[model samples]
Target: MTATIDRAHAAARRGPVARAYRFELVKLVSQWRIRLLALACWIAPALFVAAVSRQSTLPVDTLFGRWMHATGWAGSLVMLGFAGTWALPLLMSLVAGDVFAAEDRLGTWRHLLVAVRSPRRIFAAKTLASLTVILLLVAGLAVSSAAGGILAVGNQPLVGLDGHLLAAPDAAGRVLLAWVCVLAPTLALAGIGLLGSVALVRSPMGLLLPVLLALALQLAQMLPLPVAVRLALPGYTFIAWTGLFTSPAQPGPLLIGIAVSVVWAATATALAYLLFLRRDFTNPAHDGPGRRAVTLGVLPLAALVAATVAVVAAAGATGPGIEQDKVQRSVATAFSHLYRLQTAQLNRPDVTEAQLAATAACNKGGGRLDARGPGNDWRCVVTWHLPGIEAAGTAVYQLDITPDGRFMADGDGPKEVNGYFLVRTPTGDAPNPLWQFDGNVALLPAAPKG
Candidate 1:
């Protein structure tokens, strides 16, 4: 009797919310699934780095995948991008989606309520516990991936998309920053899962609902929706960290990503909190007034959709592609710069701009429309020369320019220009040692047309 009284006294002193929070934390850490997930977060990247290190070909499609086999820092960034797409949502949902539903599944709601006077405190405790788990998991993945990549491939100078080279320390710092940047989206995904968990009241629905929602949002980004809508999506923010790897690092996308993620997370969490407040844990069937509960629930969803439509309408239609004169001038200048870089790598004499005598004739869709703006239909015929190569063979360039004046060009020219070019080294002929400007080239701003 004395022990029971002491226990009661201790519980009373601690307060109901604090005690519930402690209970939730204990339950969360004790679960086998959470343990396995934490272990996987640390071990999976090591295995991935080890296995990919053995491969011959690099994954060029992904932002940093092309350098993974050769650079450890690149490999970590590649893994971070890959994880954001689906793995992150699944990991967050593992605990969050089941946090509330599990209580119902195990018939422990009554016991929990008996221990905790207020249901609101119990709800807050569970949400806090799930969020805490997400935070730890993200930190673990970042550390493991960085450590694993360094161990597997070694810290090498990382090449940016614009052909800039970052030193080992700088590369590592940027890669870690990229990993840290993804936490915004991860937290947003966790909140989504928590909201689903409370609303669905079934473990499986809660788990799969957030995952499906995330997948749908990802697919929507591919559609030709307004820029505002695309920017608002969680998936778009996932890749925003790539900007950190660029020269003069672009922060606009990263800032927008963080803001959008915060809004999404806050909105979802607020809705979940409201729903939990109204829920009747003692009797599963009756959860406040059904009509009023649904109206409140639908408000969040309606707000999201209405905001998307409003932004899309406000942005107006997409602008026309870049002008033809602008494209020709931009292409000629960029091509000359790229050729000079190539020549420098070969230990060959630099080609003068006057010697380049570069001339470009561009057309869009085989002359179907005015080649004035950005589009994939652009094709430019460029003529330039090296000492040995003939000017007779014109380089056929396919260019795609963004509305923001950024462009990527691919040319059907000499094989020497395609992959690793041969350079004159002191010790016989060797492959060009630095990052090649083969894939993408950023152009200088075109001069104002007269």
Candidate 2:
């Protein structure tokens, strides 16, 4: 059709301003994929919250506590870092990959341009459609994840990075804010995928290439690149999100992360539009050797894979080198060695799940102290009280784990010989150890939950 040819010719000519809007609208349907992705997103966080909420090990409740336990209660933090850092970028890729590239996949670009009557308008539509849906899908996933988390875990007090527990209101607010901050970095990821889509119109690999590129970037971050490299990654948003855990929570990294992602996204999208316009689909030579030399050409795949291996190796090699430290050692395989049941302790009247529930009412007010001893030994000062003990002075106890698996306690002001572990007993009673004290060495052993 004369009309169809004209439209194709126009998408090539649309100025930068128009292309932005064009890309955004065409993929409003990304929401369908989002709806599906939502199922997995919602279910995963909820299940984590539920599993954590039901656990008897953590001294209290929290999202990170659940995350920590999932990290095998602090013992597996290094392993978690190695594996999960890639997750955000991978997720962002699913949506970004389909944006501009999907038009090519469906063979709609030429047809739609004809219908639009203006190349500029088509570009605007596509860009707008892509960005809008990407933002919404991410927002929806965040909200759903938070909602499921709140409902599953209950808005209980949250423990902080310093092991300081926060009241419910602040805890709830922080979690939601952290989820929102994630949006900026995620958009950066979407931007990368969008650029790939726009550039690779003729190939099915367009959908997959952006993801491969992101992984490559993640890998490069680990190599001995200049300092600038660390500051520039679009997906570095995930790392910046770590602010949610730091004391006084720094926004500097998060804001910088947004700036980098946005700038790169804008630049990449502009380049894609220029390149796509210069080539005519009808021209066989466009995909020929000359254009081939412009990119890593056929080698983005090899580059991406090599980067993957490098990063995995780099992260493993560069950790804090604390493997031999006692804090890094497992006291007993957690949960595997269940605390030897004391039927006498269980039969005691106050030690019931109901009494343990009383702990929920225990007003959480405590100061933090970081203390260390002779054996690669670090002490976490928990100034806490067992509920039901009002006259009891605030005790700053030294939570010491020896160079081996042994834990020791030296604290001020308590006739209690050890800290109390409020536990559930199968023999009908769960101790309301709200104020009871126990030795610091008590670690129940069990394999991490599946």
In the order shown, what is each candidate's alpha-carbon RMSD?
6.4, 13.0
- Clash pairs detected, candidate 1: 321-373, 321-374, 322-372, 322-373, 322-374, 323-372
Instruction: Kindly report which residue stretches of model 2 are placed more than 4 angstroms away from their true locations once superposed.
Output: 1-27, 30-35, 38-44, 55-88, 217-228, 281-450
Model number with the top lDDT: 1
TM-score of each: 0.78, 0.55
Q: Compared with the true structure, what per-residue lDDT tens digits does model 1 show for residues 223-339?
A: 445455555576556866766765556566576667777877778788878888878766855323445545655577657756754654454522332467757765665566556
What number of clashing residue pairs does each candidate have, in the order they appear? 6, 44
Task: Give lDDT per model, in order.
Answer: 0.69, 0.45
